[model samples]
Target: MVHEGVLVESRTMRASVAEHTEALDRAKTLSLLPDGMHVTTRMVADYFEVGIEAIRSLVKDHRAELSENGYRVLTGAEVESFKDLTSLDKYTGRHLALFTRRTVLNVAMLLRDSIVARHVRTNLLDTEQWARTASTTAPVDNSVIHNLVAWLDARIRETVAHQLGQHDARMTRIAEDSVRTVIGQTVVPLLNHAIRADDERRREISDIRREVAAIDRALRARMPVGGMAAMDAMSWREFEEHVAGLCRRDGCVSVANTSRTSDLSADLVGRTADGRTLVVQCKHFAPYRKVESGEMQKFIGMAKVEYTADIALFVTTATFTPAAVDLAVRHGVTAVHRGLLERWSAGRALQVLR
Candidate 1:
């Protein structure tokens, strides 16, 4: 017998029963796309009878596992192309996250709180055991999984072809690489492994699929690589909030965004682990733009002199210009350009604060 929280906590058990997404229907009716092959985040949240934030939180924590089961965010022309194939509302933003039935099942296995998710997990476990016993003698039907895979593959090829705009000589290589990346790298190898392996052996395939997803994400993503890539998408106001998050993560207490127009232009203010005043100025600029000497000079003096900051940080998605870097060094401010910002956001300790 499975323990009470076994399915919610055990990734291996989840994978074993994930194909049994029929369990979800037992919990509640799932509203899928017109084609019945995909569902929006809202749909998943509604079916689980949880708040939308609950679904988003689960995805945030277990994206890799959910992604392996066919959750993906569509961007740019891919969004338009996807809408052409099926309706998507304006509020989806520039990027839209979609999920397959298997993806929903993966969520059911991971989510700990929702009553519907718990019901689905329980049903899935029971179904899994019965299927194994049945398959030992009778011929098990594989039509559901087979049809889903076939339709999903064709749709992926269609979307990638359209989104990459595989035209003109210049874009040909890019299109080929991106298409080959999603299809060739992600799906094909996993499908082959699933076909060859028995149920127990499929556990080993999970880690390999995760690695494949990482590589595939890098290739197809419009998002930049590394920690700060997400910063590119943030508004200036949101950037301040993000820095506050980073500061808190690194053990700052009472961190808050203090965006102001005064001589002390610190966007964030907090204290380090040792209670030293920490101040930060964030420049949410494009990569081509640099933190100029004037901006750096203003911040350096204000953070150190006006605010009496012990740790002054100048962080930007864009790098620092030579003059700005020199001034920051002279003033003892840590100039976190794109590379250093990436390192910091990726969880490396800010060496200076320590």
Candidate 2:
């Protein structure tokens, strides 16, 4: 008979080569998806025709690059949530599918129009003065970027929590799907717009507020137990709470708000962990709004006398004027917009915090 030891060695070599080939295939596939595609283990199995056990080996061999490029190795609630939402329609079995579809389509159309407007304004950025002035080809400021990302995460969580609490599953899911579409289509160009808007960008802020209100209206009208106004109020509260949390985390200690009094000096205030008090002015503008230079100047003034904080921060869901940013720098204040916040909170950067 052939030598048993030789036979075992041959088998081991074959297994190793097969594993190498499988790993290379997975790496190639991962390179194709966006950096944001949070695919699950099951999806990987389905797509790659591999066993769950094999996935571990493949991931281990290729994870360094693949994981960094958005093929995250998920577990715990992350994996579970991704699996749960893969087929959201399954949750609609007990409800009227037709009603759900209509609501979703209407919300989507409204969001689409907003996206178009956003795109038009953003396209103006390349020629805009502010963006060129503020543009930094180097890596951005890590702390400022992180604060913005955390702020956006708080906003999304607040919005989702409010929607879930106020509306039935069908309507809530519809609103979510619609919002996703709008973000995908509008957000990129909107960033460009935010980057470019000079002194005139605050007009865009008004537009954003209308868009935000529209989204709120579409989602709130589907609330199961409350009037639309009640639902809207709940969402606004959640939004404020979320903003407050962002301020607290970003070295602002005692954050508060006064949309009621319209006192713009310091809507929020607190101290950094180092005992340096900080003041924050918040603007939860609509989807198309841009904060003006005047507001930035006002925050600087507030920081000097009223708030008496060590630093001033302006946090908004909209863009800011380049002059506003310059003014903040001159006055030792920080201005943060939504996109930076979203990326910091939900993007790869947050991993460092953990």
Candidate 3:
């Protein structure tokens, strides 16, 4: 989904900041207290000079120790989990998911520079540019730096929204260090790999399309004659409803035959909540004939004029030519062959299409 303004929502940013700050405060407080002394949420809150609510949240959110029985505590993998808990939120997860392994690492370094910038009179641009240079060891786009800056800017806005007062110098230092540690280490490295993985995913999709085209050709050459009579007898409206139902069941939203023109008109229009609209041109062609991309393009052109859909879809009881497949991709249309069309029509509305 596309996001407006700063990518991360304000609440998540504040949660990250608060969780980091409290974690640091807890660490320092633990170090100072006697060996066997108990640490309650109240004591931690009092120590940090924050509310009890804040301390309680930090313990749970950061997954840090809560000193049960005043001495015994979680350790080993548990300790590591706490350390990894700082920026565990949806936006951060999405960022990690999208960025490459190297890019994530670079971002973490950039975040460190940004945090330091917050404390000093150092130039923001220069600090980030330096971080990017150090991380990549190559010329980097300043926009990447700017995106990190935007992230920081959003956090600052979040801090304000939470009604959190001005941070004391000690608190600021704790926050800056803690945030840098989490972002630079865990989040950054993971995201870098994610970026590479995403590229790989797109390449895989391209390969699959090629394979599918080959399969389509084989299937088109030998159409199933047994279903022809049943399909021909079914009205277009019945088939449209059947397909629309299947799409809806698959978590897709669709509009069908709103204009109610001839059989050649687009039968179904599908939309995702994210504003991805696809106009479906359904053709119940004779089994042996393969539909050409020229016909698909013709539908796409009409769809743009009639439905103004961002995407065009051709679903037919026939395969499309290789040229049609190429044209579909070039024009951002999707061509679904007869087998897929049959799958889209399973029952009551039109069992014949299946």
Candidate 4:
């Protein structure tokens, strides 16, 4: 007997089957066996030209329904018996899910991705219409009607299988053409966009590097070449006033020159626009000389503790020793070298040399 919708009550099955005779037709069209014969899961997969794994996945998802409708897990003697019946000596595994013709048809009706299943459905509809016409005009014998229906079903299945084979070949050619079309339409534009973005990034970096190099050269050119001769010409008090004036010109407010010996670490004190106290220590040394780390250590202590300044600037007419610059950096001090002093004195923006 057919096991399709076997889980449902006999009364419900009759009502449902009467309302949707197409489902029964689809089953007959896709079935590998004749009306009374049994089929397996692998047989159904092969008949539909789809993967066995696809059938297994469908059975796994609809286990309850499929199991009730002629799906069985063969074990022990049943497995060996099945192997013997099929003459498959290599089929040694047990606990395998076997599907009947009804279950296979059920899977075909439910499957969404298989093109062969779709063709099977269409062929079933066509066969059902032909069967209806033949039944009305044909002889009253039940056996003759059954034989006629079986023949028509076989013919429909064969035609559909041939069409699916041709479709598979056509799809293979279409897939090959699609690869070339995708490379031209999609991949090439993405590659071109990446190339353009990379070029723009390189151009922007080059422009920034050129601007920085230009600023560096201008600062170096402004540094004194004649040593302390240019700076020593002015008095010590004049040098203190020069630093205070430079600070005031460069956004420093409330500038004061405390040049007396009592002024411990700060020679000039001012407030910036952001209201941060600026503490500066000036050294008008010769261009050949460098400020030592010992002086920087003393200035760092006063800036952190005594002055409580937000920005500590160590300005000099000479450059700083590597040790002095390192210490200044460690303590977050801005070490203004001779070039920076020249740049500031010339009214250019102060670019602190940390």
Local distance difference test, candidate 3: 0.46
Task: Give the distance in Å from residue 273's predicted Cα in candidate 3 to where it truly belongs.
Answer: 3.8
Tens digit of per-residue lDDT, candidate 4, span 1-354: 233223122434333333232443332233322112345677678767788898888888878776666778889997776554333455667765676655665566556666666644444444444455445433234455457546655654565556557667666556545555655586557656655665665665567567757955774456454323345556667777877877777788998876585558788888886788888999888655888999999999998898898888888877777688778777888877765565456566654311
Model 4 residue 181 lDDT?
67
- What 10-residue stretch in candidate 3 is worst by lDDT? 29-38
lDDT of all predictions: 0.75, 0.46, 0.46, 0.63
* Off by more than 4 A, model 2: 1-236, 249-264, 347-354
Indicate which candidate wins on TM-score: 1
lDDT by residue for model 3 (3-74), tens: 211112333322222212222211222211111112334444443345656534444443321222122344
User: Which has the greatest lDDT?
Assistant: 1
Stronger candidate by lDDT (1 vs 3): 1
Off by over 4 Å in 3: 1-233, 262-265, 343-354
Clashes within 3 Å, all models in order: 0, 19, 11, 0
Model 4 weakest 10-residue run by lDDT? 27-36
lDDT of 3 at 307: 74
Which of 1 and 2 is ahead in lDDT?
Answer: 1
lDDT of 1: 0.75
- At residue 349, candidate 1 shows an lDDT of 75
